[model samples]
Target: MNVDLDTAKEGLAVLQQYGGQAAAAAGSLLAGLASPFQLFEGGWGLNLLFFGVLGLLAYSLVVLAPRQ
Candidate 1:
């Protein structure tokens, strides 16, 4: 069996579309993970403190630490 140029082009286009969608989804997930305040909204009290601590921990663990 043999494939033509048009079929290969169409396949590539489809792959590109899927790749774009996956990238977009990954970006959204990262954005959501970047903010913990939104997920645990509290009215300027212990809830805010809790979220702040969580955010700090996440930053220190992920950003401050060196990865191999």
Candidate 2:
């Protein structure tokens, strides 16, 4: 009975450690995904700038592409 209790406690400790790591990983992933939209959170000027930069980048890619 004592051995069984020790084994169960060890198992629970390992599970808790893994669970904490998983939660931290999930939070970091969410923050990374949300970072791109943070530029738009600054309102109209930032939004315009973001779109303008994106457009310029796209135009550059098209203009600089090699002919097939």
- Candidate 2 per-residue C-alpha lDDT over 1-68 given as tens digits, one digit per residue, 9 for 90 to 100: 35688889999999999999999999999989867766766566787788899999988788766543
Any residue pairs clashing in model 1, and if so which? none
**Model 1 lDDT-worst window of ten:** 35-44
Q: How accurate is candidate 2 locally (lDDT)?
A: 0.84
| Weakest lDDT window of 10 consecutive positions for candidate 2 | 35-44
* Runs in model 1 lying further than 4 Å from the true structure: 37-68
Best by lDDT: 2
Distance from true location, Cα of 28 in model 1, Å: 0.3
- Per-residue alpha-carbon lDDT of candidate 1 for residues 1-68, written as tens digits (9 for 90 to 100): 79999999999999999999999999999878866645455454766787789899999899888663
lDDT score of residue 40 within candidate 2: 63
- Clashes, model 1: 0
lDDT on C-alpha atoms for all candidate structures: 0.83, 0.84
